[model samples]
Target chain A: MAEAAGYDPLGAAGTWRHQRAKLVVYTLLCLFALYYVLPLGVVILNSFRDLPDINRNGLIGLPHSFSLNYWSLAWDKFCVGGTCAGIEPFFFNSVSMVVPATIISTAVGAVNGYVLAKWRFTGSEVLFGLMTLGVFMPGQMVLLPWARVLGWLGLTNTTSGLVLIHCVQGLSFTTLFCRNYYVNIPDDLIKAARIDGAGFWRIFRKIVLPLSPPILIVTVIWQFTNIWNEFLFAVIFSSGTHQPITAALIALSAGGTSVHQYNVESAAVLIAALPPLLVYVFGGRYFLRGLTQGALK
Target chain B: MAVEPVTLTSVKAAPNHGRMLRERLATILPQLVLAPSLFATLIYVFVFCGWTIWISLSNSSLLPDYSISGFHHYVELWSNRRWTIAYTNLFLFTSLYVIGATAIGLLLAILIDQRVRAEALWRTIYLYPLAVSFVVTGTVWRWLLSPSTGVERVVHQLGWASFKFDWLVQREMAIYTVVITGIWQASGFVMALFLAGLRSIDPDLVKAAQIDGASMPRIYRRIILPAIGPIFISVLVVLLQFAIKTFDLVIALTGGGPGIATTVPAIYVYDLMFQRGQMAEGAAAAIMILLALSLVLVPYTIWKNWRERREAARG
Candidate 1:
């Protein structure tokens, strides 16, 4: 009836209006994209511009000359003593910490999810409840006591300390995901296995593990992203020698470095973003599938 | 019930051993699978959290001995003006950020759900910030808001001299700068959550509303919003948890400086232990945070479990 009044919901005027609205939304989203991507853009664009270019050109300008000087500067010269200690070492440090942390937590969480889902127990729910609690505790509360414990155990300021901290922090959410997803599995399969004289570990290893491909992927991606970019615990547990790139980048933020270091900063920033961005783009479908399965509850 | 009984072969398995061993393995395997998580949880809670609580009661420093000093630390934390200021700022910070982030994120989610084009592109736009670590973002935003050599400078040069984009320098506004930076980084996560929630609404409800001659806004208000209530609760809990732990941005942007104007509880604890050499005071503040977190989290856990259990029983 509305269309009959020559409103032309599908005609030129209607089409024009719809197209204009779409263009407007698209423009706004593009602007939002800029807002979201600026830190990265700034870092990447500036990475190529050298010291004088950074100084003369200001932050928003197209560089008159591009150089790898600042990446070299960050790598070789940014240290207090001017040793040209490039970001390469920190890159290796981060990879080492994040990989072990991600694997341990995700593996543990997968096992946890399988058990909680497939088995009945007197106190399983209580254990699950505690896992959730550990997930939310602020990092600050744990740092001091953690320092003492680390000092006592002689792991204080080591890669293992950072890994332990990240793993502990990552556990609660991973467990939550595993538990929620495992709950969605059927009971009959477990019963059938039990009837066949399979034990709990065997059934979990064979049945529940195979059935958990989607969630396990999600858990790995989430933990991997989280630990890769984790800053606070990295800062607290690491010092000059064993620092992750995040801790290294943090120096630029604390200032007294250079006001015109925007390009250098942008380049360094881009480097930090590379790991997770690659994960999302390459494995985006798996990423979203993981997100939906883990977070939808 | 039929399977719950042991059969003649089960009797032989139980008595003769081979099958009984298999049965025991079946039952115990789940527990074994549970061991690593249980071990991690115990260490996390008992070792980490327990030590945190112990330190909170004492006069321990950077190198704490764990020896008790009664409630002196807690008393100092309560009376100290700086600590009080930090707590007040954090309270206001968390409250405003959580509420604003959720409201804006949900609005964006709704707007995006209106059959817009290039949805994946839009989502990436919003979510790309999450990929930027706090280290880079806090500095970039700080530079953007800088009084002299930043975006503000460019705008001023374009003949907007009256414009003072210096919230970061002003003591009163410094905390707000951190808040803005935080929301910019985090609102994307909330948007993603709301987007997922929005996607799950039954199409039939929307069609039903449309057939009744209800307007789009009315449909959303009455039908759409309610369907997403449970998700709203999830976003709320996650947001609240996030708000409680905000630290990185403030540290990066202001370092809790300009006279500690932007100081928050987490920063305060970090300052005491790492920077100020006030280990006991830091410990006390950590306790206060735990107490505050529990004040919300414990009740929340209980309420959620009760609701879930009630729903299960009803089902």
Candidate 2:
């Protein structure tokens, strides 16, 4: 409304020129929106099309015949390894990896954030700054050494290993998220709790923890989507039965010596992409809020 | 209940002890909670980075032998033609992708800022790609760009018989196809950031500019754009690091293929370590990638610190 007021006084005072410009702007926005939507749209439509029809009519064409075969095949029969078992196993791997990683990272991050916000030690700010540095550190810097470290610990090629890796890597972002959210909680409430002879954990348990649902939701959704969609770590660290859907999707779609099964690939990618897509559809505002918090300030 | 006589020293010492205990716990509590994540960062980021640096200088291969060498891997990495191509591709992709993503994102952000209807729907449509993995993004784009079943086929069906959009298989221009997909995936994310920045700008400033008889474009150019300059830098730094670490996208899309046309340092590092079993050289390439990241990140950090200091000073 304020933005509307700012522009309403001089420009677009009910003129033909203004209407024309408005049409152009709306058209461009629609076109860009379409551009962003087209690929996913193509995938969704192609997922239902039979393979032969897809090859005949191209990606954007109307399906000559629709088949749910690809989805069933993707779920039951797409082969990434020697077994012809579908992406079902890998999807479960992603779930197992994502759920625990999200919970652990979010819990650890909440405590870290609480302390960083409320209980400032001598070097806490310095520590916080150092942790923030992890956010910008490229995964390339640690991939080789990390693989070696995981092997040394005998945890390589396991879901737990991937979970641990994600939880650790996720600390920077989740802690930052929780810290920013907790920073806005009034200090008086915390001080009052301190006066009531409550210890640190007690205050957090009774007061701060109750106030954490919004940030927890944001952090969980963020970590879930991130871990679910993560590729680099999953590819290098997990193989065979342990690979997450992201890695498995790559293998199923284009990895190894296999025929390029575009229909199956489309269905599997849609399956791979659907969880986060649903989250965005339902939790768009929260997702946007988390992003802006992490990215902008 | 009988009142007991309490010594002054007893009362004084009791509260003092309580205070001291509380103070000590306060000092130690945060460290206790923070230790796990800090330890993880220490091992994963700092220690591993140091290990990488050391390995880069050593004669490690296949199984990571720990003999100290003198930059042999770096020398070899630089001299290899494939490495040269990957390195060049890194810069090329970074520049084009950063510029393209930022431009398109800014354009979309501005377009969306026009008080449009279905704002949330538009935002969702534009932003959904960011939720999908790069692997999927690359795979989908690869399929869409393939000649037999993709853009070329569709356009040819539409009677543009000469239409040929086969950059996915071309050697000279394959990198640009990666750039295209990168832009497609990321531009919306950047747009979200820019839209947030645009929304946060004080509307009063825009009003003042409008009252000065400036057109909307002029007002934006002279007023709004400069106000949100920091966001552009932030987006650029973030995208720059992304560009440096690009691996899965290029792998799934191009597989560094058509004769290694789309190879980047990340892929090269992966190939060396995992595929070729050249651990030391891979570590060396990894370090180089870290160096490239630091080049962007270090300056961004300094700029942020300076800006924070300036804001504090102003306050």
Candidate 3:
């Protein structure tokens, strides 16, 4: 195959035909990339540019003025809904809600995955199938019940309530991810551990836990981004100070202000997006791994 | 060696009893660890679904009333103008969004699969939108699509005064705006999936096809795409589900506005239950969304299972 004329296995031989194909390919890819990056770039630039500059440049042009004030204002001074305390509180609300929810859901899911993959009690497969049904469940179906549940628990309109809701809702996905990953671990290793007098927790601690960091990271990133970005629940269950950044961004954008504060709102939107964006940039490999596993399975 | 047999047996039995107890604990531990999640899923999935279903059947309003009202809300929901429009819009949005995203995604994936330079950078750019919340995506897009400050204004300022991209505010065109933003947000995800599918195709097949003088497009169409047929279905099902549950995007993008022109079933549900205090009707609408999702998902799941079973049996 390598000896054949004009048959480049590595695809690096720059025949005229190959060069033109590469040109077309790069052109299309760059065009699509521009479409994807345009909004983000506009937002990023507008976030730092003055409102007057944005007004003059119509949001798609080079910045005439730049300042860090909008970031600060969006952080602590600008009003969202009725509060002048800015998006700071709501950002913290997302943080607090996401952190515990991610940890609890991931921990519980890790154990559930371990049991479902390794323990294999009778009917466990059925149980897992039923649990995974939660993944496909629309949030609308559970809104009324969740509202009532939260009310009964006296946790309505609180971040704790949102955390509880997320942890429960997130379990199915986390469990599915971890279980799928854990199923690939050879059974002989577990059997060997069992023969060595290792029990359930011991085997998990010594065998499974060490091999879990990859899936664990994937699950954490998945759950973190998801819970942070969750809107329907945040909007429905919480209000005002307790709302996450997603909900607050809505209020801020639609705050019925006569004039849109493009700069500050832009900064606020970026603030809301920063966490997941950072996660995606850093753990992109695991993020995509999670997405594929979470979607296809 | 001279020890009594009774003492030896007693010691052995004691250790055996302890070992049995330990074994019992080990057997139960997994169940114990697993029970909470199972219970939670049972409540969250089955019970919550049942609860909503019940509410949809009841005449609940202002607050939940347990009294069975016998599908009155479902009837009312079907008759409602907003609900009808919402669902009709959902169908349109779902079809367009799914097709558009999948087509664009397949193209991008194929393009990237040419072993493009800076593949990671390009993939990151395309897929980054999935990282941001829909609220953020919608907000940025809403800005860009707004006539006053968005593309229209920029084009108008740039020596072209007749440019009109006011779909965001137009009553009839608002839904298309949602579809566009959705495709923008989701196509990357589909692309990622397709790229994976493309990469997973056996190299020899392509090599053989090339040796047979098959062109690239022909090779992709006849060989690579057919190989990734399962991925196409997966992407379709996933995108359909996304379109069905689309609330945040619509809320942030158009707020189901231009006078309910863009009202999706999700926005309708939220409006009915939270804003209008029509809880029963809202629950009914919510069920409709679920039904729509299952309509796409059930067939997919069955086919997947059947395919797996056939493969297993063959193997």
Candidate 4:
């Protein structure tokens, strides 16, 4: 029924038709790829132009003359608040907070995840489920209450609070991924360790921990990216000195100076995007795996 | 923080309690490791949420008040023009974003799954947005879409003079524009999930379908779709949660402006608390939004978990 009409209805060779179909599909897929990609290209190109050049050349146009002037301007001589500070401070703040947060979150996450996957206990699934639920709740809706909590702790507008929030938030999804991933590990390794008289802690520390390096690396990269780009909590709980790169980007964009410097803003935007872009370039495989298995799982 | 094994202290208090202690330690370790996270959830969801619910009933202003307000704020919310627009816009935004992201994301996933060369590069290009906060990406989109001083004005100069892509400015089209940007920032995530699901699909099925003269689209629609149905549901749930709780894109992009055209429940609640200083109304609106999400998410989660338990039992 499926094949009778296609064999000779058009009187074309089967090979010819199949080749044509392949070519068409390939073209369509490439076009779809372009649709996903061209906007980013436009952004990259637009970032290099000056304000006047942007008006003259348009966003889609290639820059007639590439200049590092906007990048410089965005970094220095940009009065953020009564002082000349560029995104440098924001970059520093993001690194300081995100680094500690990423490390702490992933570390605790590893243990929590290890326990969940390895241990069979009462209400374990319930604990994991609740963590998963927290992951689904968007940070904006929860930002206020968190900020209030932080304020009471005297951590509001501080680096400590932002880092803690990131660690806490990173717990749910990270633990979920690590747990699911660890579940697939064979049980015989633990059993063998027990036979060797290895303590539970030693078995986990010496055997399972070292073996799961790929996933741990993946977890670290993903959480670093997560903490780096976090905004709502950054905005709510931190101030200028403690803000992440994202909050800085927002502050810069919203507070336009001198006829909406789109090129500089674009440059700043591109600058803000660098860490993530670089992370993806280096660890794209791990990022994909982590995303697939994390909250989505 | 040390991972030292405990002697099952509770059971160790009894003599010759070795076997019982092992059992007790096994039970206690998971809960201890899980304690902080569990306590956080209970406090955040149960306690603060309870407080939010309580305040919605009381005359809580910027400061707390114990006096009862009844259904006053809810009635006011029903009457507020901006809140109504916000609710409608939220519905539209969520619908468009969930649909658009899933569609494009699936296409990307399928293409990548089908032995695309330099898959890592392409996947990276798609998923890079997930690394940036929505605010940063939202700012990027805002600039791209702004009527003046953005790509809109530039497109006019490119000799296509009638390119009226001013959806960001108009009331009716503003929400749609936000949806487009939302999809742009998020579909990569959706694509990754779909790709993972696609990879787990048995190659034999594709081979068999091809042997049967089933075209790619037909095979995908019939075979792949059903196989990936659970994944589809999961992705949609994530997308729905995102679309409903959307705030940064609207705030960073439009500020719920052009006459409240792009406001969602999130932004509506934000304005009530921060901009308008109407804390009770804001809390009420937030509770309403939470209730709406819980209505869909809580029940669906329960059903999915139930089905999952049954399936696991079968296995």
Estimate the TM-score of every prediction: 0.87, 0.94, 0.95, 0.87
lDDT of 4: 0.75
Q: How close is candidate 2 to the true structure, as a TM-score?
A: 0.94
Candidates' RMSD to native: 5.0, 3.4, 3.7, 5.7
lDDT of 3 by residue, A1-297 (tens): 011222233363348878887788888888888999999999999999997788778978889997999999999999877779989999999999999999999999999999999999889999999999999999999999999999999999999999999999999999999998899999999999997668888999999999999999999999999999999999999997889999999988966746999999999999999999999999999999888877766
Best-matching candidate per DockQ: 2
lDDT of 4 by residue, B239-295 (tens): 877777787778788878786778889888877876677777888898877777777
Winner on lDDT (2 vs 4): 2
DockQ of every predicted complex: 0.40, 0.61, 0.57, 0.33
Candidate 2 CAPRI level: medium
Q: lDDT per model, in order?
A: 0.74, 0.85, 0.90, 0.75
Candidate 4 chain A: minimum summed lDDT over ten consecutive residues — where? A1-10
lDDT of 1 by residue, B145-184 (tens): 6677567776766778787878889998888888788888
Q: List the residue pairs that clash in candidate 3.
A: none
For model 2 chain B, where is the 10-residue window of minimal lDDT? B6-15
lDDT per residue (tens digit) for residues B149-212 in model 3: 8899999998898878899999989999999999999999999899888777778878888778
Residue B30, candidate 4: alpha-carbon lDDT: 62
Q: What lDDT tens digits, residue by residue, belong to model 2 across residues A1-297?
A: 224233442253448877877798888998887878778889989989887887678888877888888899989897777768888899899999999999999999999999999988788888888888778767777887778878888998999888888888999999899998899999999999987668889999999999999999899888888888889889999888888999888777776666667777788888889999898888877787776666543
Which regions of candidate 3 fall more than 4 Å away from where they truly are?
A1-14, B1-23
Rank the models by lDDT, top first: 3, 2, 4, 1
Badly placed stretches (over 4 Å) of model 1 are: A1-27, A72-83, A255-260, A285-297, B1-29, B65-67, B211-213
Superposed by TM-score, candidate 3 places the C-alpha of residue B230 at a distance from the truth, in angstroms, of 1.4
Better of 1 and 3 by DockQ: 3
